[model samples]
Each structure stands twice: as structure tokens, then as C-alpha cells.
Target: MWLILNIVVVFWMLIGVLCLQVPPSEFWPAGFVAFSLPVPLVLNFLFLIYWALRRSWLLVLPFAGLILGWTYYARLFAINLGQEIPKEAKTLQVLSFNTHIFNAYDGKQRTASGVSEEMVDWIATHPADVFCLQEFYNNRNTGGYNTAKRIGVRHNKEMYFSIGEFGRKYGDIGIAIFSKHPIIDKGAIHFTKKESINRGVWADIVLEGDTIRIYAVHLQSMSIRAADIENTYSAIGNEESFKKESRNLARRLKRGFIARAVQVEQLLEHVRKSPYPVIVCGDFNDIPFSYTYNQLAAELQNSFVQAGNGIGSTYNGILPFLRIDNQFHSEGLKAYNYETHYEMGLSDHFPISATYVLEPKPEEER
Candidate 1:
């Protein structure tokens, strides 16, 4: 019986590793299994310790499973002692956050008057040179709700707001990029699906003498609200209700996975063709184990994996393990002091920031 259970656990571990390579487009069930990756990974580690203590050869099985999915493990956890940035280093501080529309609406109604203002104030005071915000709100007619104007005016930075169809009908709300440096060129990457409020916006900013591209992206969301999660928990005793809630949750997640796969492909094409070194930042809305992350990580270096410590979970919802936000940069840049701002829990997602310095050009290129 023990041996049978060991085989089953090993098989589950294998599925998690395979999910990274096979996208949801090819096999939709892979999307559902991706979220369970961390569970199997932890179980395998425990099994290894158990077998080792018993002096059993079964330890090799769990050990092999760990090695097979080592990359996923590395991406999920970091243990850096933290590096010091030189005072004279020409560093560019960049922040990426999902503002959840500045927490303006609680369900159908507007939140308290000062709620959004408090969030905006925290962002304005942050010392980041570049801010890439997702689910950003800006109301042109209303002076108090003009978030873009408030932040840009306070920091004296240039702003680019990518207002979508939803934002146009309802007061403006979408993704935005605010830069302290001069924005030389700017554009938006619209997904093939016209209805998606999610977007990718890019800017070419002249930093000192060199030009660098910054891509601020917000991908397709799972659409799982806090109420939906609460309902799932509440229906635990009733099997029928539990099944209904679970299916609804699964359907939302599956749709998000499929949509984000197509969106990431579109964004990658634009990223590969960039003329300047690029730093991509935003709320990915998918974990590091998913296809969205692997595709981007292939082309760029993940800031958290390089410089951050611990799990670096960025989601501020009931689901504590989701590190769906990220910052990825091209080889021409070096990342330092990557951090997730957990204390400022004003939105559904915590803001993540990192400091970067341009790599020196080769003598021939100079």
C-alpha cells in the first residue's frame, strides 16, 4: 500500500514539471494542474526526508523528482542575502502594481472618499523613477478622481494611460506608465480580443544618454472575486454546493489561462523586435509555474529570481501563495534590491519594485 501511494505521488510531481512545457492551448487540463505544482513539490520534499530517515532506497525516487523539477523550485523560492547598491551607481528604480482600479468600487458602489486617495498618496511618495500600473483609474471630468494628474503632477513625470473600451464608456481606467525621464516614443499592444480591458503599453525613455524600452503589461485575469472564494469555503459541508462552486472557479481559471496564452504570444513578438534594451513589468495574473511566465523568462531575466529573497508572493488576496506579479529585464541590464511592498496593502495586489543599472557597452559598441 505504501509503495502504491509513493508511485502516485511521483506521477503527480511529473505532471507539474510537464505543465511548464505544455501550454494550456495544447492541453487545457495543464492549466488546472499548474496551480497544484507547489503542493506536489512540497510533498516530494517531505517524502525524501521521510525515506532518508528510514534508510530506504525509496529516497532515490523523490530525489529524482526534485531534480526533474528543479527549475520550478528555483523560480518558486529564493535565498539571497541581499546585495548592496553602490551610492554612485546610476540606478533606475522601477515599480509595478495592480491598483485594482484604486479600490474605487466596493462591489457595485464606490468606496469611502479617502480610500483611493490614500493609495494614490502612497504611490506618489514612492521614489521609483518609473511606475507601471495595472487596473489604473483616471477620471478626466472629476478633479478628485484624476489619479493620473495627481501622481504625474506631484512627481513631475510624463504619463501614458492606455484606456480601453470599458474605460472609455465608464470613466477612464486601464494600464498606465509614468516616467521621470523623457518619453521619446510610446505605443500600446492591443490583444486580438477587443473586449479585454487588459493591455500592454510600452515607452522608449531617454535615461541619461542611452535609450531603454519599458513594457507595462496587464494580462487576462482569472475573474475570481473575493465573494466567490468565500462562497466556496462556506459550501464545504454540502457536497452539491461545493461541486457547483468548484466548477465555477475552475471555469474562470481555465478561461484566463487560455486567454493569457494567446496574449503572451502577442506580447513576446513585440518584445523580440524592440530596438532598445527592455524591462518588462506588470501584474501577470498567472503564477511562475504557468506558460505565461516560462515564455517571458526564456527571453528575459526575472528580477525576483536574481535579487529577491524568500517566496516573494505579491498577491494580497486570500490566496497567499500567488506570486502573479513580476519584473523581467533584458541582458543589457542588471537588477538589484528586488522587493515586494507588503506593508502597503491598499490594493488586491502588492506593489513590487527593483533597482537596475545598465550594463557597460563593449569597447567596439561604444
Candidate 2:
């Protein structure tokens, strides 16, 4: 019986690893399986321990499963010994955050009057050389807070703001990129869905002697409200209510997976054609184990895996372990001091920042 259970667990672990390779567009269920990978990972570890204690050959099954999924494990957790950046290297500090519209709305209602201003002040004072903000808000109305104006003034940087269709309909809120370096060019990747609040924007900035493109992206969100979570939790004891709530949540997740699959393909198309080295920063709205992260990581280096320590979870909502925010860079750059700013609790998502230095060109290439 124990061996049978161990075999099942190992099979489940393999499926979780397979989820990384399968596109959610091709198989939506793979997204959900990938999101729950941590569960099987823990279970397989336990089985490995159990079999090893008994000196049973069964240990090999769990061991092989873990070895197969090691890359995904590293994506979710890291233990870097740390490295020193050379003092002479010119570094660029980049910060990516989903501001949740600066806490303007708490659920369906507006938050306290002064809350948005306070959050804006905190961000404006932060010392990052470039800021990639999702759910960024800007208003030009009299007496309204103009977030871009405030932060741009503080950084004194060239700014690019792309207001999506949804942002245009609901108070000029979208994604923004602000850089201390001069922006030589700027553009946006408009998703096929016209009403999507999520979008991608980029700026080509000349830093030191080279030009690098910075991409700020916000992918499709699950649209799972706090109320949906609350309802699901409250309905736990009642089987019928629980089933209904679970279905509702699952439907939202499915929609998000499908939408983001399409959206990411659009973003990748832009990424592949870029003439300059790229640094992508944003709220991906999907875990590192999903297709979205894998597709990007295939082409770029993930900063968290390179420089971060521990399970670098960036979401600060009801979900406990979610590292949906990320910074990915081309091989020409090296990332250092990647941090998830848990200290700043002003938004549903915490801000993440990293320092990067361009790699020295090879003598042959030079």
C-alpha cells in the first residue's frame, strides 16, 4: 500500500514538472497544476525521508522525482552565498511594483482620502534609477493627484506612460516606466483583447555608453476579489456551497491562464525582435512555475534565481507563497542585490528591486 502511494506521489511530481513545458494556451489545466507544484514537492520530500529511514529501495522513486523537478524548485527558492559588485562597475537600480492604483480603492469603496498621496510620496522618494510600475495612476484634473508628475519630478527622469483601453475608461491608470537615463525610444504592446487592463510598455534608454530596452509589463490577473476568497473560505464546511465557490474561483483562474498565454506570446514577439539587450520587469500575475515565467526565462536570466535568497514571495495578499513579480535580463547584464521589499506594505503586491551592471564585452566582440 505504501509503495502504491509513493508511486502516485512520484507521478504527480512528474506532472508538475511537465506543466512548466506545456503552454497554458494548449492545455489550461497545466496552469493550475503548475500553481500547486509546491504541494507535491513537499510530499515527495516526505516520502523520500520515510523510505530512507527504513532503508527501502522505494527512496529512489522520490529521489528521481525531485531530481527531475530541481530546476522548478530553484525557481521557487534560492540560497545564494552573495557576491560583491566591483566598485568601478556602473550599476542601474531598477524597481518593479504593482501599486494597486495606490490603494485608491479598498474593495468597491475608496480608501481614506490621504492614503494615495502617502503611498505616492513613499515611491517618489525611493532611490531606484528606473521604476516599472503596474496599475499606475495619473490624473490631470484640478486638485487630483498626478502620480507621474510627482514621481518624474523627484527622479527627474524621462517617463513613458501607456494607458490601456480600460485605463482610459476608468481614470487614466496603466503601466509606466521612469528612468534616470534619457529615453531614446518608447512603445507599447497592445494585447488583442481591447478591454484588458493589463498591458506592456518599453523604453530604450541610453545608459553610460550603451542602449538597453526596459520592458514594464502587467499580465492578465485572475480577477479573484477578496470577496471571492472570503466566500470560498466561509463555504468550506458546506459541500454544496464549497463546490460552487470552488467552481467560480477555478473559472476565474482558467480565464486568466488563457488570457495571459495569449498576452505573453504578444510580449515575447516584441522581445525577440529587440535590437538592444532587454530587462523585463513587472507583475506577471502567475507563479514562477507557470508557462509565463518559463517562456521568459528561456530567453532571459531571472534575477531572483541569480541573486535572491529564500522563497522570494512578492505577493502580500491572502495567498501565502506567490512570487508573481519578477525582473529578467538579457545575458549581457548581470543582476545583483535582488530584493523583495516586504517592509513596504502599502499595496496588495510588494515592490521588488534589483541592481544590474552590464557585462564587459568580450575582447573578440569588441
lDDT of 2 by residue, 1-366 (tens): 988988887788788778877888889999999877888888888999999999998899989987987887798689877588978886889999999887765567633343478778778888999999998877654235777878896568779989863333235678989888999999989886574558899999888988889999999897888899999999999999999999999999999888888888899999999999899999999888788888899989999999999999998888788899999999789999999999888898999999999877797247
Against the correct fold, how does model 2 do in TM-score? 0.93
Top of the candidates by lDDT: 1
> After superposition, which runs of candidate 1 have C-alpha atoms over 4 Å from their true positions?
1-3, 86-88, 110-115, 165-170, 193-195, 364-366
Write candidate 1's Cα lDDT for 251-282 as tens digits: 99999999899889999999999999999999
Candidate 2 lDDT at 211 equals 88
* Model 2 ranges with Cα > 4 A deviation: 106-115, 142-144, 165-171, 193-195, 364-366
